[model samples]
Target chain A: MADETTPRLRIAVVGTGLIGGSILLRLHEAGNDVLGWDPQPAARAAAARRRVPFNDRLDVTLKGRDVVFLCGPLRALPESLTEVARLADDGCVITDVGSTKAEIADHAARLGLADRFIPGHPMAGTEKAGLDSAIGSLYDSAPWVLCPSSTDALPGFRLLTRLIIENFGARVVPMEPRAHDAVVALSSHIPHILAGALAGAAAGSAVKQAVLALAAGSFKDGTRVAGTPSSRTADMLISNRAAVVAQLDLVRAVLDGLVASLADADDAELLRRLQVGRGLREELLDRSMLPVTRSFDLARDDQAELDFLRRLGGDGGYVTGQETDATTVTYTALATR
Target chain B: MADETTPRLRIAVVGTGLIGGSILLRLHEAGNDVLGWDPQPAARAAAARRRVPFNDRLDVTLKGRDVVFLCGPLRALPESLTEVARLADDGCVITDVGSTKAEIADHAARLGLADRFIPGHPMAGTEKAGLDSAIGSLYDSAPWVLCPSSTDALPGFRLLTRLIIENFGARVVPMEPRAHDAVVALSSHIPHILAGALAGAAAGSAVKQAVLALAAGSFKDGTRVAGTPSSRTADMLISNRAAVVAQLDLVRAVLDGLVASLADADDAELLRRLQVGRGLREELLDRSMLPVTRSFDLARDDQAELDFLRRLGGDGGYVTGQETDATTVTYTALATR
Candidate 1:
């Protein structure tokens, strides 16, 4: 909600890459006074070229800002927050947009800024990076995860939550720092790592060239996240080491079970596993819970069937005995022979 | 090449789905007199709605047709070809577009139509199917694989090759039937099976709902093919059983090596494997061997760094840094970092 008499809240955004720039752009579009800071000169120039407001001096940028959003590498957040804590107003809200939370929260406590910090991670990103890739609507309808520590500053958390909901049009999902790290480790980090690994393996083989030649839309989409900077991915794994390791263990366990099924040549079990996986994917797609777009093919086919039903009069029903599910849709039309 | 004086060929296309419909549409666009045949009334209606010329009478559709293209289920191809052989002109150029070739080739030989048939497969598909999903440019720049038998229908083969190139703009690749099956088994069938199995496993789990909710773009992309009919997949596996078994053995070996490396915590070997896979993907991507829409996200940071050299007024050069491979990328980035 905007009050004409009250001045707009000023927000400082560090790291003007995709995530940071996107957050800045959204806040700006929402009529908030937003300024950006980035250590990389190229990134800073890119942000400025894109008309994203920025201040070169971090101290000046932090001065009197109602909220400072740390949107950089997970490892960089601790020291950056420490620097801002020393310069920012006592009542200013501090939040982060990193992938992991436990370590950052710990660092906030160590920096004695825990009470003023609200650790938040938006579950949104594109394969591209930098301000050039930023879009104002990037976070719309995405989940903005808020990892609240036991000693978290309630007022800061509330303000950050409101910004996420009202300004970015994102739903606020509160999660424990460790739990959030673990869930993401399973859902995001490990997948990226595995994709990179799979791509690497395929790359090293004699068939590598042909494999790529044959690769269709699926492989490209599957490996999209693997294209991120190795440096950033490195920091992610290192900063969230324990949780990542834990997720890796889970992945290995799953893989091991799969390997066993293959070893036993249990076709029935294999088929069951396949059906279950397809079901899971469909359920998520139907619910719009996943961040990816469901294939238009699926939507079109569903609509086509619905259209067929509508064309048939209310009293006209065709019983073509066919089982329909996410993985398969069969139609057997009854006709007078 | 089109010659204005050349008599127009009468072509019969016996199916109208993603691959078949695409071939028919493209051929029709190239000025061939195309007649479509499908048992399903809805499929026939959809083809007609798309203005794909069709004859409802199968006998009329096949009679006097210069060439007949059987584009339907792998299992249905043999019977359909047999029926076409009985009705079509004695020396009609016949080709069937199915993923697997050896069995169909055998069927043709057994049916005494080997001289009239040129076994072929088009290595391209969209996630969508049906006549409405067809696109004229679907086969552009993709491989159209042909498996020529000893009977050597040279005239038919050449005519078919010219037609595919002229109409679909595909690169005709000639391979032995066995080789064609093997290559696709590794590249297509096995991947679909894996996707289905993975989807099933995840769906069957206690965390099924949550797991699906967090399924990122990768899982969705990786599992897109899982939605195809299980019977279709089973037929593929059975027809190409030997090749699929061989590829699975290779995959299993690789997976085993990875498991051992993980179990031993042999960082060097693990890094080596990771490098191999990454290099495979990058090399494929860089060469444009894959039919992927070029996205900046897939570009390696190293490539970005190389591109950045243009700003320094130096000739752009590839970096031969100490860690050029995927293993180095993974270990240095994920584990050791």
Candidate 2:
């Protein structure tokens, strides 16, 4: 998958879970020098059995790498990134695949690795878990989020984004760390709360048997994440409190609006509220409506370029491709509001 | 709207459809002086051949009846009841075989027929339909639900319950009209509300394109029921207003609790709440978890029996069997607190 523009990237992927293993496999298949690591020997052995390029010593595996992806668990990422920053060459572009970004961005800043440490969250997963489910195409067409702290980190961001666009088939989205959290709070965290609440509310009803019989596909889908171990879901929800809480207030408003409409016997208002969501949902699901792409040359004023990237992310756009020299970046998106 | 007639009853069945024809056939066989009317000659002629007493004029058919069964389609029930109330004598016990109770109950109240009009739903059907399928044994052992509006309607409700229990071979369960609506609201209306809201929230997120790609099973499933036509969903929710509003309040509280826990960094409380819902959902899903049931006597205290009947329907319980004399009602239910 490596085109003529791609350099032979020396990449190390820490943590051989789905994201790490997939990143390792994809880079290795792209004719790169790639190595994988896992804190657990059993996990490393499992990947090794798959004929993956795996090493037992994480520090040695991370050494001399041009690109190091810290794909460890959220709790382990900060320490692991510190280790990767310490071992890998000063030229190494470090990134990660964690759901949230702000806390880690703060840690990277305090460690003075802003230029080398590019925070990322590649939006990819499968129902299956662990290394066996890892595939080379995991990041294909997926949105890989990047939170660039300042103008100094532009080169590292460009290097990793270009490599991904060229070989891994990822769509790069450069967003503010907080914005990423807000978006996920609406999309992921709120749904979990709604799911548990719905299940809980129904369970307490006098007509629970009726609810059980009637709650079919919708109830199941809504509550699917509540099935995740409670402590894990709580950790994820609590980890990004500000975004999750702000978005939850918005949700409470939406619900309160519905309740008021019902209380007033306002069928017209009820229909209006219900229709707003329906229209938006239809837009989200509308595959036929191909989004337009806009591009800006990085050679322009640096502030202008950064502003464009931020606007692109704000517009729900992602960088799809770029000039080999990294002068211009083109992204697919709706027009900025 | 009507006074009580003596024990011996004059019964009439309107619409001559599957349910109407069956009621006519069964009541005529039990020697209740029954009459059947169908606006369509073909349907009535067909029922006539099946030995169902037919009257060409609906006014004459309904003139002297002590009980009238408005077994028309949902869309036609309101108009049919209006016509029946116009022609029937004041003492007539007006009832109907309709699925959802709230809308028609509201209409009956508007028509000042709340005392006479008791909404009913019989959980019995076959692959076969129409007058030809009208067997005297059709309602045998079937659960017939009666939504009693008030104690003024209790006499009418009692008369109909006795008739259905004796001649129709039915088991009677009395529930308040709004309570029945609430029961169904928790089961059906609330799911639709949740689905639409979840979809709407995601579509409005700032990084919605990322959300579109990343909000997987939970997002899709949560909004799955929202695919139902908007006007249709709105109408269903609005019709069952009180119950849905109350239940949605409970849902909002649950969501608020999760938000507070996340805000306070109270992982333990968050886990406790989430685990409660998870346990409830699993219990709902567990086929092996047979719930305990307890029944009370209907003859012991008539006043208490009314309250118990309300509780039974509220508890998602149903009348399964009864003493043929209607002295003791046997219901399937979870133990009441």
Best by DockQ: 2
Q: How badly does each model clash, as a count of residue pairs? A: 17, 0
- Candidate 2 on B1-337: residue-level lDDT in tens? 1113355677889988778888888888777788889887688669758977898999999987888988856667889999899999998988988756878999999999988899987655553557877777877765577988775676677677767876776656567776666665765578778877776666566566656655555676677676666876776676567778888888777778877888888889988999978876786666232233444444555566567667665554544433223454433433223
Give the runs in model 1 whose Cα sits over 4 Å from its true position: A1-8, A110-113, A151-153, A238-270, A288-337, B1-8, B109-115, B151-153, B204-207, B229-231, B249-276, B288-337
Would you estimate the TM-scores of all the predictions? 0.76, 0.71
Query: What lDDT score belongs to each candidate, Candidate 1 first?
Result: 0.64, 0.74
Residue-level lDDT of model 1, residues A1-337, one tens digit each, is 2433335778899788889999888877777788888888787678767877888888888899888888876767888888888899998888898888898888888877777888887877887878889999987766666655643354455456556767777655555577667656655666556555445545444454444545555456545555665556556655666766655555555555544554466656655555555565666566532121122133345554433322221111222223334543343322111
Candidate 2's displacement at residue B30, Å, is 29
DockQ per candidate, 2 decimals: 0.14, 0.32
Put down candidate 2 lDDT per residue, A45-130, tens digits, no spaces. 78766788889897789777888889967877889888778888888899998888888998999999988898998887765667
Choose the strongest candidate by lDDT.
2
